[model samples]
Target: MSTLIGKTALVTGASRGIGRAIAARLAAEGALVAVHYGSNKAAADETVAAIQAAGGRAFAVGADFGTEGDIDALLTGLDAGLGGTGLDILVNNAALAGGTDLENSTPDYFDRMFAVNVKAPFFLIQRLLPNMRDGGRVINVSSGVTRIALPETVYAMTKGAVETMSRNLANSYATGKRGITVNTVAPGPVDTGHPMFQIPEVVEGTAKATALDRMGEPEDIAAAVAFLASDDARWITGNTVDATGGMFLGPRF
Candidate 1:
């Protein structure tokens, strides 16, 4: 649990759901975590408070993706919170999820989706690389929808781009002198305390979709991120770890 002692990590969109879980897990491993939120300081504060309560170090940072100067705002807060320390881990988990299909996928929707999902992470990595410590870790959160057929076509496309970017950067940016490791974690149907999970039918269907025969939890994905951020995954890079519980792994027939 102390694998991350003296490390500093910034987890974007960590106000709730999988992001929040990742923030907590990293803190528990002895890292000073920055819980990032788009528009919810209270939720981010809650995450930080929980980490502090558990005897871990954490703070809240706010910056809305897809807006003007989002990355600048995020970096400013990060720089202040870290107090001149270099970052050891970066988890790009913030995203705009759901509701973009072929019919409703207008130009505005497409731009916004790419802005938050694709553009934000890319620039974040590029801008943070200088301030990031050598041998650091960069873990990007993707989705199982990239592989499976889903109504959120635009959303899936963004994730596919993420996978490709991760692989490219893993080889070009993180290798050799840098020694940093870049990887992606794609989660399946996760129950992130959403109201939809309250429906029995939704839960049952999602459970049946996976080989594990259960809906995934936020903690499940968090565990995967924690593993990638640790020294244990040093040899592993430019890969997408499917933390999907075997979803869409062929028919049960």
Candidate 2:
């Protein structure tokens, strides 16, 4: 974990769930973390306090990622937080989830989904890359839904786009002198306090869906992102690391 000492990381949606876990993990590794949140200042503050309590450095930044001028606002906050330091890790973990099937999906809903899940990360990276130091890392948080059939067609499509972007960006940005690493971590059936998990049946079904016979925790996904963000993963790029607990490994039979 000391490998990240003196490095700096930015994690979007770090107010809760997997993003929160990732921020904590990175901070534990000795990186100064900038925790980004959409509209939850209290949650974001809590995250920062927790990191500091654990002998780590962290700060919270707020910006509604799907709205107009979102990238500008995020950069404004991040610049203030970072001072003159360059970014060493960028985690695109914020996204809009939960969309209906094609028949029920609306144009507005679809656009919003893309705005946060796809467009936001795309432009955010475009703006952040200038500040990212050589040998930095870009980690996109995708979903297992992209590899399996799901009712949330719009949401799945958005993740698919992120996976593609991860590959393409790794190729385009990770040049000889740059050495940047870009990758995606796709998690499956994570227990993130979503309302849908309140139902006992849904919980049971999700647990059984994985070959491990247990739903994933936010730390599970965070561990994967931590690896990709570290110097140990210098050779690994343009890849999707499946953090799905063997979900969709094949029929149960």
lDDT of each: 0.94, 0.92
Give the C-alpha miss distance for residue 175 in model 2, angstroms: 5.2
* Model 2 pairs whose backbones collide: none
Q: In order, what is each prediction's RMSD in angstroms?
A: 1.0, 1.3
Per residue, candidate 2 scores C-alpha lDDT tens digits across 180-219 of 8899999988889988887899988887888988889999
- Reference-based lDDT, residue 54, model 1: 93
Task: For residue 37, give model 1's deviation from the true position in Å.
Answer: 0.5
- For candidate 1, the per-residue lDDT at 133 reads 92
- Runs off by more than 4 Å, candidate 1: 173-175
Candidate 1's TM-score reads 0.98
**Best candidate (score: TM-score):** 1
